[model samples]
Target: MDRKKFLKNGLLGLGTIVALPTAMNSCTKDDSIDATNDNATDGSNSSGSGDCTLSPSETAGPFPIKTPADLVRENIVGDRDGVAMLINITVQDQSEDCAPLAGVYVDLWHCDADGNYSEYGGTGMQSTNYTNVHFLRGRQTTDSNGQVSFISIFPGWYNGRAPHIHIEVLKTNGSSIRVTQIAFPKSICDTVYSTSAYKGTANMLNENDNVFSDSLEDNMADSVTGDTTNGYTLTKTIVV
Candidate 1:
């Protein structure tokens, strides 16, 4: 499918739509994998053993990256400040006995430490203006192991949503496969938010988030190991 058409179909197919509040502060409001046979935490198949099912499809907006092909890089931390984090995503083919699926492109983006997304802001929904800068956004292709890693700062939270990352998996031809969001563990969120860069408490938690509350078993990270002192690593597997 053409990228534009895919995005249009995705938006129209959503069962529920959450509205972002206008006049909200930039620091407020909201807001994987794999193949079968992988051991993932929280009963997911990322790091601990779990069922291999199709990852839940999610909405790609309020702010989806524009021209994602131009932002391909491993280090996506463009001037955003926060605790360093390494995001590792593995893609698997459920049809092939949960085997690794290599060469697919993964586009990932998230808000910075202030809860402000790049390429959007200075509006009623996001008070800070970041329209010209493209931070915290990048794309990379899965390797032979069907894994892609990104260097980013721990994301900050805003009102109405929890700290999360948005990812879209596409075939080499640019056709969309899955668009999903990943949730951070509350324990890790608490520790990351307490740091100087992300000083306030998150107004929303995974249990309270509209998108994650019901599908957290598959949406939440399999493991989030590390601390503010040494940075963190988030690993999850997505099966499609």
Candidate 2:
């Protein structure tokens, strides 16, 4: 079977479970957390069982700059300002018996807190010009434990779309094995949007998003606990 077709088909069933490590589970507490400062030992890779499903694949959207070769760092928040956010992603090869996919390249990019994507067209929320601003976009290689994390801000909302982040998983040779978008819990979005830093006021829901609506159960990201006040840590396990 083609790798791309297999991934899409596998996600249609009960295969997209995002397991969190015990260490990164501190968000359950209501106290404030320093997500950026704790980057050394923040997220954990490998879910005990490899039986979990892969994250559902979705469109890369209208703004995607940089290629696999451009990935040089783990921290993609290049001068963007907003509430702190930590994205913890684990990639495993389901085709290879759910083995940890070490050395895999994971690309993550999203819009800024103002609902604008850098280096892309800005039509509705702002001007119709493209800028060299490349915040909230970065790449990281999976470790021996099949884990890669990014330090960013809770994504802002925009028209015709829900609060989400785009991720592309590729092999060491830069061949894309999986492409998908991670959706945020609506409750979290509401809480984050209430803050002053995030001024974008688009109220689109997961059920309304065209791509996510078809696979809401499998596409919706696992529930996260932290808020904008304490910063957020989103953990997900992706089986490719």
Candidate 3:
């Protein structure tokens, strides 16, 4: 869907970036974890039961297709080619004493390996009929663990921005609550781009990206593990 449709249907609307609170980097034990919870894995410090700092909001970037019939699935890559990646997102509610938020719908979408967005205009792509073909876009519902994971390809870079993934959290009734983007570490991005499929022009660093220039939002960076040859796992908590 286009930007008009997305805003009309409770998805993200075009607006100024929402910087993450600086205190999130130093969140104290008062924002502690719940003893009964066990959703964390792969060395993630974020837990579902803690009163986490609210994640910063971000622009939806003019390419989200948030219609009712777009289809929701765990594997968003389809047949797209690039290094494999696993994105693990944990959604926690800052309002409910930081309880694990279940049944929330998480929308994840990104460009392909060549920096071409699936349903958007790009070089060598059909700009006039971009919406007809949808790829690298999908949604997954958070389980009891407050986690929704997706299998996708490592995203590539384009002009004036860094490599990142857009994520939106919608309530059970389909109303959007939080909109944000996740960034990969520069070192990890370097390693991923070394592969032949991603060896094109490099992306701008986070400080150069307009949306990520705010220092407080640095927490948006993912905890990435693994390599280009064996695939990678990117994990982050979505505190809304």
Tens-digit lDDT string for candidate 1 (1-240): 132342233223222121211232222223231123233223443332355776767778698999899999877877777777777788988778779999999999999888899999989999999999998999999988888877777899888988889989999899998888888767668777887888588998776677676576677776676667756667778887
Full-model lDDT, candidate 2: 0.65
How many clashing pairs per prediction, in order? 18, 2, 0
Q: Which stretches of candidate 3 lie over 4 Å from their true place?
A: 1-51, 66-69, 122-130, 215-219
Residue 67 displacement (Å), model 2: 3.6
Q: What is the lDDT of residue 54 in candidate 1?
A: 69
Candidate 2 residue-wise lDDT, 108-208, digit = tens: 89898887887776565556454666767888889898988776777897788878888889887878887777777666677778888887455777767
Model 1 CA deviation exceeding 4 Å by range: 1-49
Each prediction's TM-score against the native? 0.79, 0.75, 0.73
lDDT of 3 by residue, 1-240 (tens): 132332223212211111211212322222112122121112222233324766666778867765624658766776667877667788988888767899999998888887777766643542444555677888888988798777677898777778889889998788898877887666667777887888565658765666665522434443566666656667788888
Rank the candidate models, highest lDDT first.
Answer: 1, 2, 3
Whichever of 1 and 2 has more TM-score, that candidate is 1
Sorted by TM-score (best first), the order is 1, 2, 3
